[model samples]
Target: MTKRLQLADIGSALIVLFCLVPFYWMIVSALRHPADQFATTPFPLPVSFQNLAAAFAERNGFGRALLNSLIVAGTTTLLTLAIGITTAYVIARVEFRFKNVVLAIIVATSMFPGVTLLIPLLKLFVGLDWINTYQALVLPSLSFGLPLTVFNLTAFFKQLPSELEDAAQVDGCSQWQAFRAVILPLAMPGVFTSGIITFIAAWNEFIIALSLTNDQKMRTAPVITALFTGQYKFDQPFGTQMAAGVAVTVPLVIGALLFQRRIVDGLTAGALK
Candidate 1:
């Protein structure tokens, strides 16, 4: 048993190292001077401050783009979670005709490639005159991400004891009151997990934001960062691009760290009971 445990530990360590190797390389390359990036021995420590400065300097309006990404992602996460939690409670705890069919349709729809529907979606948004605006960026993300959020929250809500709702009802609470006061508080971990996932999805969403918005000032960080490369000479400098990548990744890292405890609890809630 001890030998087996040792092997498991070794395997886990190898997996962790493998996962970190790409991040290590990105940090290393990002820190290197562009001239030395492809050098024979390319190992170098990250020049943290210098790279951050360069990234901000060369990427015109990158700061604004970063702000746009944050606003869009934050709005999507909050709205998605709010709608998903309420709807999931109904789906999981309440009996209604065609519930399974509704869920099946949602799951099936999610499997469709997003790119295939872009033309029609763009036209719809264009008809609504939402182009080149924050609404264009956030509304589409919410539409895409909401289904998964509802699915995850439904599963989690089903695992919760119905006794809590009963107790609240016994204490003269309405269904909405019980839900808002009792169930929602208890299900916070699941809600936070869903929000984190939604935020990451919106943050990384490039195609929709890129397609719908043409104004440079209205661009998200991912879209603006992509214009770095040029045919003969790069429009944005290499070090700056690396720095921008790092910048884009930092908020996601922070969000994951903040909600990590909730994520674990949300995943393990069923197992515990």
Candidate 2:
């Protein structure tokens, strides 16, 4: 048993190292002076913030792009949770005709390719004159985010015992009151998990962002990062790109680290049921 445990520990360490090496290299590249960026050294000898600075410089407008991402992702998470939670609760706790069919349909939407809906969405947004606006970003993001949120929350709501809700009703609470005061609080782990997943999806989404917005000012971080140009003629500014990657990655990393336990609990909440 001890020998097996040691082998497992070694294997896990190796896998973790394999996954982290690229991220470490990206940080090294972002911090290295441009002259030494391509060097074979594992660590930068003379570190510099120039690459990070350049990526966020006024000329690049990555700062504005980052803000745009935050707005879109944050708003999408909120809206998805709001609508999805109610819909999930109804599906989980209520008995109605074709309820299983409704759930199957909701889950099915998530499997459709985003690209398939791009043209119709673009046309709809154009008709609404939402082009180059934040709504253009937020609305389409909901299409993708809502289904997952509903599915996860539905599963979580099902796992919660109904006795607590019944007790709330016995105490003079209405159904909505019970949901808001009792069930919602207890299902916070699933909520956090769904919110984080939705936020990350919106934050990292590039194709829809690119297709919807024409103005650079309205562009999100992922789109701006893809279109980043070098200072010198014909150069790609690999260092600056890496810096932008790190900047885009930091929030997600922090969120995951802080809420990892909740995320796991949420994902596993309805698995046994």
Please tell me which predicted candidate would have the highest lDDT against the true structure.
2
How far residue 268's Cα lies from its native spot in candidate 2, in Å, is 1.0
How close is every model to the real structure, measured as TM-score? 0.89, 0.95
Candidate 2 lands at a TM-score of 0.95
Q: lDDT per model, in order?
A: 0.81, 0.92
* Candidate 1 TM-score, true structure as reference: 0.89
lDDT of 1 by residue, 112-222 (tens): 676886899899989999899898888878866788778877888888899999999999999999999998888887787778878898999999898999898899999
Model 2, C-alpha of 223: deviation from truth (Å): 0.9
Deviation of model 1 at 16, angstroms: 2.0
lDDT, residue 122, candidate 1: 93
* Alpha carbon lDDT at 224, candidate 2: 91
Give every collision pair in model 2.
Answer: none
Candidate 2 Cα deviation (angstroms), residue 75: 0.3
